[model samples]
Target: MNEMHHRMARTCMVYTSAALLALLPVTACGDATEDVPTKTVDTSALQPGSYPTEPRNVADRKPANAASIREAIRLAESMPLAMEVDKQYVYNQSSSGKIYAPELPPQQGDSVWVENFGAVIPGLVVGWTSNAQQREDFALGRNIDQTVLRFSNPDQAKHAAKVLSEDNRKDSPAKRDVRIPGHDAAISYVTEQDSVVTWMPHDDLLIYTFVTPGLEVPPDVDYVIGMTKTALDKNIEMLAGYQRTPTDEMPDLAIDTDGLLGRTLPVDDMNKSGATEGVYSPHAALHLRGRADVLKRAFDDAGVDLVADAGARVYRSSDSAAAYRLVAALIDQLDPRYETTDAPAGMPEAKCFKKSDRRSSRFTSIPQFQCLFTNGRYVAVVDAAQIQDLHQKASAQYLLLTDER
Candidate 1:
């Protein structure tokens, strides 16, 4: 809960096998729950936001090439994935980025699907998003974002902008052309959604903004336009940086954050502003590299099969009626019914467990909560600690997976 506690709380999230969980009950969370209290800090004398200012020293900093800098930005904005990295608690939290070819899904030339962007403008060079975290923010939600796509060259960028402008003018309502600083940008407001969308072009990058779903209240037209301006300003600064002093190395970005969660359930507990270092709890921490050997053996022992479909890996059972039963049995066999936690209301009958009891020094002190349940034809492993309300999000995820979308 506090800064020092987070560091000393260096606990790992373990997807403990039944055989493994047995080793802990005697001296861990089941019986021995004593933990050293973390030390407290005094914020009285220090300013609440005190941080080290940029130093005046001028050694060991190497500026990268424009291409490398651009490439780094592109890597940061890899699409299909959510905005894992963005401007955080810093003064500037807006950035433009693109994805390298290898990181994207397998494509056949023009067959790429822009996952984060609207999937319309093809060659996505500078897909930008903002961290305008505030209340009542649709097209401008801090969670949802908008971006414009551009190709490699200026001619391509201008051509894409032209196509978007023509399409917006013909199809979008309340169409208007506005100037951003020295550039002419297209702005459109849709009455049906009460949201505004904008597109601007500068050199090789195409900038755009729109309403995205948010956790808080839905956003309105004014908030979108204002944030678009903010995004545009940040874009101008980034492009300028590319021209002038390039960064030695790009700032670190968030990692691909999925390990123990169900395929349908998304786990993004890392703070966008803080990168991975700003984790709040084990709710978002699941690193299952060395932890899945027993899981594989268990599956093999039970006759369940694993298969890959459309880039996603899923566990399958030969019999449809017995599928859920088999999956539940695996968990039950490992963790008995009496030891299981009751299923949250609306969720299928479930059992819960923690991978580690923090019984040993090698194990993490952090607590990892694993919620195993069944939904429809599949057994679910929902890490309730990953999200705020485990029941609601897991239920919603189950419904969304069942839906026709």
Candidate 2:
């Protein structure tokens, strides 16, 4: 995908519920009764040279604080998902600390200190925002945001938490101190806008949580406190298993350590340098998806350990059977407007879908066509505006995945 299109896909929030799949019909093979036109490609004559087998290597490719940036991405996967706090908070967005300036605070006055604090900016900051309703109408439901700031040591984390709490309390007199149930060191207060904010320092990391109610109800202090507690507890538990990279070894951190990105197809040569195209852990991949809650279970069941996003999204499953199951699960979770039409001509293992006449103003930006296919333990998903283009991309992706070299 191009840079512009990748940005749009990252922020766009239209999603279909997993439960809705029961109402739609899907087929692994083409529907004979459907008159959808398909393009046929000569698979036997396809050459591996037609698609990129390895990611391009740029000279002097290192970015500023590359090690810290990479560690921040790793920390993001350990952060708690919104659904873990409450089932209602199934919608979420993930962000890395690298997005902000390391030496300066965020421009917004009421922003979380984890993004960037006065002289005490953390080595890395990762966050997730979960909502009870769809993005188009999030104001109608509850929302919770969780952020983790990893400092150089326990002392720095404690100092950063202290500085943030003191500064925030002095910023406005309307802020009222609120006591958490079991966290005595936690500094929490209710803002004038009725949102609850909490900052707690644990070991070498600072945990931040913000809870806000929907427009339909008055701010519930008890609900806010309960949710904040749940978020903190879950984060602490998950972090116990995470091993932070040593400060001295961060700069040498490898980008494609497992060679997954090298094997995946790359975008067109002109747009190959985009930052959005990279390999990610299964948990990190959830941040880029719309229905992360539903996909989480599928990812775990299929043992989907790695994901690579380039011209096509590639997933590494445990085995071929798991890959096929993942593809079926993906097709079932597609928006209801998409109907199973046909597989790419001459490729029975592939499955394709096209948007039907059904109209919904909420999902206009979604791609009109998508195709999914598996080659051994790897599953690839490709999208396009035209059926012919989708078929060609699918064929090329299949060849790239099956290449022996």
What is the clash count for each candidate, in the order shown?
12, 0
The lDDT for every candidate, in the order shown, is: 0.33, 0.61
Model 2 misplaced regions, further than 4 Å:
1-51, 54-66, 94-137, 154-175, 214-216, 267-278, 336-349, 352-369, 384-396
TM-score of candidate 1 on Cα atoms, chains taken together: 0.33
For model 1, residues 87-184, the per-residue Cα lDDT tens digits are 32111112212222212321211111232423544544333222222221112334323343445665666666666655544333443333343445
Q: How good is model 2 by TM-score?
A: 0.69
What TM-score would every model get versus the actual structure? 0.33, 0.69
For model 1, the superposed segments whose C-alpha errors exceed 4 Å read: 1-144, 148-150, 168-171, 175-182, 185-192, 211-224, 242-405
Candidate 2 lDDT: 0.61
Compute the lDDT of residue 159 as modeled in candidate 2.
Answer: 79
- Top lDDT prediction, candidate number: 2
Give the range of the ten consecutive residues with the poorest summed lDDT in model 2.
16-25
